[model samples]
Target: MSTTSTPDNLELATTAREMADQAPAGSLEKAVAGSVAITCATTRTYQEAIDVLGGIQPVEVRRPAIEFLERLAVAAR
Candidate 1:
């Protein structure tokens, strides 16, 4: 895949790198781990977690969280 370092892409990349630094090793494999744990550890089902996440977070944050939850659900199936 080819990527152009557009300003938006660069910014996103930098932010992702910063966030990655804050996470433990193997975190990329566990990107959805936190949401899964939260859903499992609580009474929330995956759909409920996806719906509720948007209400709790900003749109930018919620969008990715929901997407991650969706991808997790697909992987589970």
Candidate 2:
């Protein structure tokens, strides 16, 4: 976690983990990413990320997607 996260991120991360855990089996990563995105967008319902973002492809893009999810999840609080 970064300086911006602190305790809020912890709580949010836990919630996110629960959300992710409840997601459908094969789409864990997408569900998590969508949860983060929905939280950041302050949407009442969580929607899966439509793009094929969670795939393990090039490193540069993958890392950023993870980072963006974390940042968004924290901001969701």
Candidate 3:
């Protein structure tokens, strides 16, 4: 399979990287953002990536990340 770095995709990738970088060190948000960044770089969906990393638990703790991932997933398409 081949991947082209379209402007939109590149921006998304950069956004994901920034999100991961801005997140607190060793925080769940950081981990999730990092995982999502990897997923965004590939052909996989955010849900698939999140699930594999163990879906955000308690909901409240990861509410922000969840919302962000949802937006990213939509944008990814």
Considering every candidate listed, which one attains the maximal TM-score? 3
Tens digits of per-residue lDDT, candidate 2, 1-77, equal 44343334345445556656776776746555544444434432222221334453554445555565555555664
Per-prediction backbone clash count: 0, 0, 0
lDDT of 1 by residue, 1-77 (tens): 11221223233333334444566876542343354344434433444444566563334455665565554445334
Cα displacement (angstroms), candidate 3, residue 77, comes to 9.8
Clashing pairs in 3: none
Residue 70 in model 1: lDDT? 53
- Model 1 clash pairs are none
TM-score of each: 0.46, 0.35, 0.50
TM-score of 2: 0.35
Model 1: lDDT to the true structure: 0.44
Alpha-carbon lDDT, every model: 0.44, 0.48, 0.58
Please list the residue runs of candidate 3 whose C-alpha ends up more than 4 Å from where it truly belongs after superposition: 1-9, 44-67, 73-77
Give the lDDT of residue 59 in candidate 2.
49
- Judging by lDDT against the true structure, name the best candidate: 3
User: Lowest-lDDT window of 10 residues in candidate 1?
Assistant: 1-10
Model 2 residue runs over 4 Å out of place are 5-7, 28-71
